[model samples]
Target: MEHRALGRSGLWVSEVVYGNWLTHGETVDRATATACVRAALDAGITTFDTADVYALGAAEQVLGEALRGVRRDSVELATKVCLPTGDGPNDRGLSRKHVLESCHASLRRLGTDHIDLYQAHRFDPRTPLEETLVAFDDLVRAGKVRYVGVSEWTAAQIAEALALADEWGLARRIVSNQPQYNMLWRVIEPEVLPLCRREGIGQIVFQPLAQGVLTGKYQPGAAPPVGSRGAGFGRAPRFIGRVLGDAVLDRVQRLRPLADEAGVTMAQLAIAWTLATDGVSAAIIGATRPEQVTENAAAAGVRLTPDLLTEIDRTLGDLVDTDPTKTADMFAVKAEWARA
Candidate 1:
């Protein structure tokens, strides 16, 4: 439960944040969600990340109900907007109307008057960045949201937001960026990650385990076990095997020996390995069971050795990009590897 600063915003968050993207409302029942949140809190996790679109807001309701007994002021709540709750034209994107309305809706669902962190789920090319910044500024000025952030946003988009915020005297500042960054997905490393560090925004990474791919759950020749994320109703991304392509699976298979040597699950090794980087402020961990929560919490302090990091670099086949300057080097290497 080590606390790390969320950039220069001064909001201290636990290194291992509890994320409720799946199982909270879609697969797991309310009681189970409550137990999971309690388990995370008991393990010293203070930051909880959820999205309004997750389970179409049922996730927020469940999280709000589950955390009722806990001290609200002691916890840092982070949620997102900009995703469609319905098919309406205004139901999605970063429009000022949608941003403001969505914030209130999330507040009601989350049972909180002021969200500690409010983030845009993605870059909205339709709405002008000025409109989004002004809306976020309005929320911060009205004390509805304590801070502003973006998820899965590119470095260029984030810079544009910052510039607009500066020019408009906006009350909001981009304190953090939450992107999918795991041992398998390192696309954030080259540009977006370094840009966050340069702009004083923290990197609150999501899917640090590649949704159990790094957990060694899907054996080479065996079917996925029952009740796993891939086997549950929340099964599209992980089950589609869309993200678990051969390159990803091959790298994962290669890491088994390294994880065994470290006396840690591959999940822990991957999570700790991500945190060992320079700019990650927190790692968003999705745990369905109490034991999983406890297991991932150990990721906060575990350090990867230089030798292990080197071995991981070699096996991961250009996944973890250490140098911001050589941004496209890894991509070129991947192309060459594919050709070979």
Candidate 2:
């Protein structure tokens, strides 16, 4: 597993970070989660990313249990806060009270004293950015967090946070953003990627396979696999436009030959595609099984030729959104090289 610096923060994470999303408390058993984690560690995946709200906090507890007996120094643990982990008014948002409280809950669940990277899972409009940044700074100063970051933030929101942090002379700085990026969806290109590149902030994208769509396991017009997330994650409810509409399946089908030629699965190809770009610190891939971890890790060595990359992009066809006004544009970021 190759390591990359996570933005301006001195911390380094594996190029392929492990994530626990739908799998932690739903599809995977404790033994299975441990096996998957062990496989990732064996393959040198040093970073494990999870959110405080996943499975209503079961994911964090399970992850902590899974890491038992493993040397802590060998792995990097990254987790997020701020997603209504509780119903109380103080339970959510980046307000200083909520931020500090959430940090403690995550810390207790993960069984770790300090989180390697702590992120605001989404923008909290109610909380002042000044309050959030200062609270995060306090965590770093108090040795509760090593780095601070934001997720699913627009470029403007990210800029505002940076400006506020700079003004405050805070102890921590925003070093990374976690967004969803894949061959089928590239909204971050125009919205957030450019700002990251300009500020030297690293990016670790979530859902790099479009919530299993880019894996090419689900053919057009076919039912989702039994016991799979798509069939079971009805409550999670993926956006219809991104997941079901616009012939995403057809485009995914066209990539089969390319993945085969590279001696990898479509999932591997999609993950590698994200990493091939500069400023992507890591591609966080979640798995329900150990084999999926191995399959994704295999992508580390598969490099797409420039011609192949261009061909793939052209075939994928305008999946990377350029307009900032569209809701989908939040997902499709403008590529730094994209002609405005």
Candidate 3:
């Protein structure tokens, strides 16, 4: 797998990161999850992404077991905080307490000494930004977290964190930002992309296939395939359901010919497209089966010509969502959760 520098930091990550967000401990059993991780390692994927919130931390344990014998220094491990892990008021968010405690829990679950990338899953408006950055800085200084990042944070929020880190002379700066980016979901392009580009923060994007919609497996006007995310086989049908409309599925189907012309599967084409974007360090792919991991990993270095990219845009005309405000809207939802 091709490796790229994560933003301006010295850390490098695989172009295709194997992530177990919905599969491990939720949809797939332990044996199947181990097989998937094996497939990723065989396919040259050394970067593994998970979160403490996934399956309420079962995912991390599964991932840890999956990589038990593998050389720890050979792979990059990334996880996130700022999500509810328990019922207590201190069970979530990016407060200093939660952040510090979550890192330790993640370490024990992952069976690792230090996290390669520890990210804020979402911006916590209720917590002071200084507290969050300082907590991350503490982790870095204490040899628990190597680098700090944020997920689904708006450009302004990222800027604030960077500014605080600079002003406070923290030990580490934000090195990456994880967001949902794909051919259909271009919300991060208008502001987040440019800001990260200028600020030296690489984007480790998730859902590069638009929650499997870009795979062209879901046919228009037809029921979702059995065992698909939209069929409620994994976590819930909520995320994939948003893009299962006939309009979106039909347009997605139109891109199959482009994939055929490129001599790659629809999934590979979808993943490669995300890597083609500027400032993207890696694209995270989740899989239920080992074969899916092998297939998607092959898209690592697939180069799409300018004409092919233009053809893709022409095929999916007007189906893409590029609203910059959508980032803020996501943050607003998280803020509401904090209030409640």
Which predicted model would earn the best lDDT? 3
> Each prediction's TM-score against the native?
0.91, 0.92, 0.96
Pairs in steric clash, model 3? none
Model 3 agreement with the true structure over 1-340: per-residue lDDT tens digits: 8999999999999999999988899989999999999999999999999999999999999999999999999999999999899999999999999999999999999999999999999999889999999899999999999999999999999999999889989999999999988898788899999999999999999989878989999998899998888897544576677677787887888899999999999999999999999899999999989999999999999999999999999987766677888874432222221232
Specify the highest-TM-score model's number: 3
Cα distance off (Å), candidate 3, residue 126: 0.7
Q: Of models 1 and 3, which has the larger lDDT? A: 3
Model 2, span 68-132: residue lDDT tens: 88888888888898888877888888899989988999999999899989999988889877888
Error of 2 at 17 (Å): 0.6
The C-alpha stretches of model 3 lying farther than 4 A from their native spots are 328-340
lDDT of 1: 0.82
lDDT by residue (tens digit), candidate 1, 1-340: 7999998778999999999887688887888788888889988999999999999999999999988877789999999998899899999999999999899999999898999999999888998888888889889989999999998787788888888888877777899998877775577777887788888899899878877878877665455678776666644444335444455566678899998888888888989988988889999898778889889988888888999998888897664434443332222223322332
Model 2 segments beyond 4 Å from truth?
A: 233-242, 326-340
Ranking by TM-score: 3, 2, 1
